[model samples]
Target: MSRRPQLTGRAAVLAVVVCAIAMSLAYPVREFIAQRRQIAELQQQQAKELDALRKLRDRGRQLQDPDYTMRQARERLFYCEPNQKCFVVMDRGKAPAARKPGRAPKPKAPWYESLWKSVELADHGVSR
Candidate 1:
C-alpha cells in the first residue's frame, strides 16, 4: 500500500498560521455584529422620538387656536363666561365620606367621659 503523507514541518507551520488568523479575527467579527445591533436599536429609538415630536407639534398648533384654547379651559378648569354659571356635579359613589362639620368639633363631653363611654361600648360588643 502507498504510505500516507506525513505532516511536514512547513505544512504544520501553515496550519498553525491559519488557526492563529482565525482566532485573531473572531473577536473583531463579534464586535462588528454587536455594533450593528446597537446601531439598529438607536435607529428604532430615533423613529419613536420623531413620532413623539410630531405629536407635540400638532398639540402646539392646536393650542394656537383660540377656540380650542377656550374649549380646553372650559373643560379642564371649569371656566365660564361672565354671564354664565358653572356647577360641578360630583359622582356620589366616588365622593369621600362626609366629614363632621367644623375644623375641630369640641368634644361633647370631657375626655374621661368619652373614654368611659368607649370602654362601656367595647364591653357590650358594640362598635361606633
Candidate 2:
C-alpha cells in the first residue's frame, strides 16, 4: 500500500504566518495605490488651472498695452481716426433695395448726428 503525505506542524505554522502577513499588508497597499492615483489626478487638474491662469495673465498684459487696446477698439467698436470716413458694409440679403449698387448715393449726415444716434441707441440698452 502507498503511504499518504501528512502536513507537519512547523509547515502549517509557517503557512499561517505567511497568510497573516499578506492580510496585514493588503489594506495599506490598496490605500497607497489609491492615494497615488488621487495625487496624479490633482496634479493634472493643477496643470490645467495653471495654463488657464497663464492665458488670462497674457490677456491682461495685452490689455495694458495702448496699441492693443486701440486695435481692439477699432475692430470691436468700429472706431476711426478723426476726419477719416468709415462705411459699414451690410449684408446684401439684409440691406434695403434702395441701398443696392447703381442707386443714388445717400446724403451724408453730420458726424455729430450719427454720434448722437449711437448714444441714443446705447441709452436704450442696445447691444451695438
Residue range 42-124, candidate 2, lDDT tens digits: 99999999999999999999999999999888888999989989876768568555666787888999999999999999999
TM-score: which candidate is best?
2
| Per-prediction backbone clash count | 0, 0
Candidate 1 lDDT, 1-128, residue by residue in tens = 98867998899999999999999999999999999999999999999999999999999999999999999899899889899988877775687767787677565788999899999999999998
Among all windows of 10 consecutive residues in model 2, the one with the lowest summed lDDT is: 92-101
Native-to-model Cα distance after best TM-score fit, residue 1 in candidate 1, in Å? 5.3
Residue 42, candidate 1: how far off, in angstroms? 0.6
Model 1 steric clash pairs: none
Poorest stretch of ten by lDDT in candidate 1: 98-107
The numbered model that scores best in lDDT is: 1
Q: List where candidate 1 sits over 4 angstroms from the true fold.
A: 84-128
